[model samples]
Target: MLDIKFIMENSEIVKAACKNKNEQDNVDKIIDLNRMRKIYTAERDELRRQLNEISAEIGEIAKKGGDISSIKVKAKEISEQVKSVEEELSIVEKELDRLVLTVPNIPDSSVPVGFSEDDNKTIRIIGEPQKFDFVPKNHIQLNEKLHLFELERAAKITGSFFPLFTGKGAKLVRSLVNFMLDIHTADGKYYEIFPPFLVNRDSMLGTAQLPKLEEDMYRVEQEDYFLIPTGEVPMTNLYRGEKLSEDDLPIYYCGYSACFRREAGSYGKDTKGLMRLHQFDKVELVKIVHPDNSYDELEGLLHDAEKILDLLGIHYRVRVLCTGDLTFASAKTYDIEIWAPGTEKWLEVSSVSNLTDFQARRMNTRFRSSKDNKLHYVHTLNGSGVAIPRLIISLLETYQNSDGAIEIPEILQDYFGAEKIE
Candidate 1:
């Protein structure tokens, strides 16, 4: 959540920031609500002072044992007025909070002004697209012919966008998860955490996934917990409400978890395969760092994710996310897209974002300065160190051979215990 003081002091700047991000916010109404809440508070305090004075006078009349009824009645009327003012104050406060939540995080100055993914500029291309002589098959066809997947049973059990992996498909999924984790944890010391599948509402808000993406999530109504949409949700909340010392400036965490999303609004897109799913496996990298170092951490995190596609020998590209394409918590974001030759498109495999104090403020997660002992909000960041299923899709499509074999990348050959998956 944004600080009200910041909003009050920088209303115009905030409105301009929202305009650049192509997001709509009722800035005028937000300011008006703040004004109303402040006015209500002042009046309520004044009324309470009057009520206290009247009660004191009533007490004196009672002590004197003469004509206390009039004083008592006056005190009672003041109490009712105070109650009415208090109720109005409560309404104004709620409206102010709702308005504040509607205002999104401002884009960093470096963020380019754009309204859609089409306008995103490529920062650089990591590796060349794979050269293939034969016609490459998509993951769906390859998985089916090789007896690697069973969607029929998956549909019966759940519904569309769910696939059951068997034989090679299961191994492929496991291998992908293991491979991604190993790379992210190599020397970087990303503490691996296997988080719970379900988390409370506060967990969702910490990562800026709630309030807006609430509809896309699966909530257990009675328990008031929601199935995690991604490892990002639980991983970031690990340090929720925590205060770290300066020496703990950076906390790197990598979590493996099963993510569930309703795909609630997406009706017909990527329904045939793992491009989008109700449930998928992922490894996410989350960091809590000093504000000055967060942008650099963003690059490091992106490279950590890019290293996977590079190691897999899969062709991919990295794009600096335009402001409009950024997540609610991110000040700046970079998405890693892998080339899926069969589909003739780039599949986004990960998004590395730098959220400077936006999440920390909401979570009340802070860090104390080593030099001055001053507490400050830490900048938070997270990325799919890589998601399993989509990367699998890219790998299968890029490595497919004319003989219906899929050559495993050299780095993962030993992990999967064979050079080729056929």
Candidate 2:
């Protein structure tokens, strides 16, 4: 949440940011509401002071054996006035709180000014898309010959976009999860967390996903719990409503979870193979760090995620998301897109983001600074160490031989208990 004080002091700047984000939140309405709140507060305070004075006067009159009825009448009038102002103030404050939550995070100065993914700037291509001696088959064609996955069975069991893997396909999923988890927990120095897949409404709101993207979530209506869309949602909220000391300036956590999404508006895009799915696996990375080092940590997070692709020897590129492409709570984001040889396209596998206190404010997660002994919101960051299905798609398509066997990357061969899948 953008601080109300900051918005109040700089309404125009806030409005411009809203414009840039193509959001329609009314800055003027918020400002007017705040002004009304201030007026009502002042009126209430003045009336309270008058009520106290009337009490004092009445007490003095009673002690001196003077008529106190007039003072009592005045006290009654003042008390009623104060109650009226309190009621108005409460209404205005509630409205103000509601509007504030609608405001999007202000974009960082470094973010490119643009309106869509097409405008995003490419950072660099890490590895070249391999040239094939024979025609490269897409994941669907390759999977048909290999019999590694069954989409028809999955569809019959759980509707479309649900994946059911068999043989090495199932083992591939397990191996990837373990391999990614090990990288982040071991060399990345991140503590691993196996968080609950279900979360409450407040937990969803804390991650800035509730009010905005309700339709995209799966909710257990009876229990009011939401199946998490990403491990970031639950992992980031671990320190919610808590305060950490300065000694713990930087805290890192990596979580692996089965994510569920409704994908409500997506009708006909990437429906053929593993492009988009209703349920998927992901290894998520989250960091809570001091404001001074958040961007640095963001870079570190990008490199950490990139290492997985490097070890797996997947060809990929990095893209800096333009302002319009940034997620609801991210101040800045970098997406890592891996090349899929069969599809001849780049599939986004991870999005490393620096939320820059936007989420911390919502979660009420703070840290006390030793230098000033003042409490400040810690910067929050999260990324997919990598999402699974697309990576699986890339792996099958990229490493498949002319004979239809998949040569497992050297890093994962031991985990798969074989060098190749035939």
Candidate 3:
């Protein structure tokens, strides 16, 4: 949520952001509603003031044993007028609030102005794509001989696009989760949290997922709860509606969760094995930091996410998302795509974003400065330390031997326990 004052002052910039993000422009409506709200509020306040004076006059007349009925009637009329203005004010405020939520966050100055992912700027590419003497098989083709996962059975058990990892596949998923948690929590750089997978509407709204992406989420209609789309949702909402001390700035948290999404708008896209799923596992990283260092924290956050791929010895590249490709709540975002030799494509495995104060404002999360004793919205950032499905796809394809065996990376060997899945 942007400050109404800021929107009023910077309507043009906000409008541009809406255009860039491909969101509907509601700045004009919001401005008009806010103006009406101010007018009604002032009218209500002035009427109440006049009513108070009339009541005082009535009291004096009563004390003097004089007629007070006329003054009392005037006071009643003013009181009724106050109620009318209050109702108008409430209506305006409600509409203003709804429109405000529809407005996308302003893109940071550094973000490139582009209309699609093709226009994204590549920051750097790390490592070289693995070379294979034998023709590499895609994850699905390898799965046939290796018997890692059963997509047909998974579809039967729980609709399409849901994975049912069997035997070594199951172990690999668990090993990856544990490995990521260990890396992120090592040296206490990030606090590990295991949060609830189901969240309420406010939790969704706090993370800026409700108004825009609600259709893509799984909802428990009876309880009005939503299945979390990522660990970032639950992890970031931990401090919702709370104030923290400045000393607690730069709070880091990492957690693994099973994310669910309906992919409502993603129909007709690649639904190949592990390409897209209704449910997936991911280790998410979130940070709450002082505004001054938020961008710097974003860099560190991206590095932390990249560290996972680096340790796994995967070839990946980082691309800074253009404004049009940015998420609703993110001021800036960097997507990490891993090269999948079998798929002959780069798959996005993580997105590190600096949301600035966009989410903090919605969550009403603020920190008190030690120097000034003033509360200010803290900037929020989140990233996929890495999502499992695509990573698994790349791993199986990249490390596959000619004999159809998968050699686990050295760092993950202990966790995976003799991981040559033959």
Whole-model lDDT, model 3: 0.94
The superposed Cα distance between candidate 2 and the true structure at residue 163, in angstroms, equals 1.5
Clashing residue pairs in candidate 2 are: none
Q: For each candidate, what is the lDDT?
A: 0.85, 0.92, 0.94
**Model 2 agreement with the true structure over 1-422: per-residue lDDT tens digits:** 88998899988888877876777767889999999999999999999998898898888889999998777877898899999999999999999988998888888899998889998999989988878899999999999888888989999999999899898899999999999999999965999999999999999999999788999999999999999999999999999999999888799999899999999999797777889999999999999999999999999999999999999999999999988888778889999999999998899999999999999999999999988999999999999989999999899989999998899999999888999988
> For model 1, how does the per-residue alpha-carbon lDDT over 1-422 read when each residue is reduced to its tens digit?
67888888998878887876766777888888888888989988998999888877777877888788766777788889889988998988888777777778888888887889987879888777777888888888887678777778888999877768888789888888888888878896798889999999998888888788899999999999999998988888888998888888789999788889998879887766778888888889998888888889988888888888778888888899888887777789998888888777788888889888888888999888877789999999999978888888888888889887888889998788888987
The deviation in Å at residue 357 for candidate 1 is: 1.6
Ranking by lDDT: 3, 2, 1
What TM-score goes with each of the models?
0.91, 0.94, 0.96
Model 2 ranges off by over 4 Å: 49-77
Which candidate leads in lDDT?
3
Over 57-83, each residue of candidate 3 has an lDDT whose tens digit, in order, gives 888889999997777877888899889
Candidate 2: 10-residue stretch with minimal lDDT:
17-26
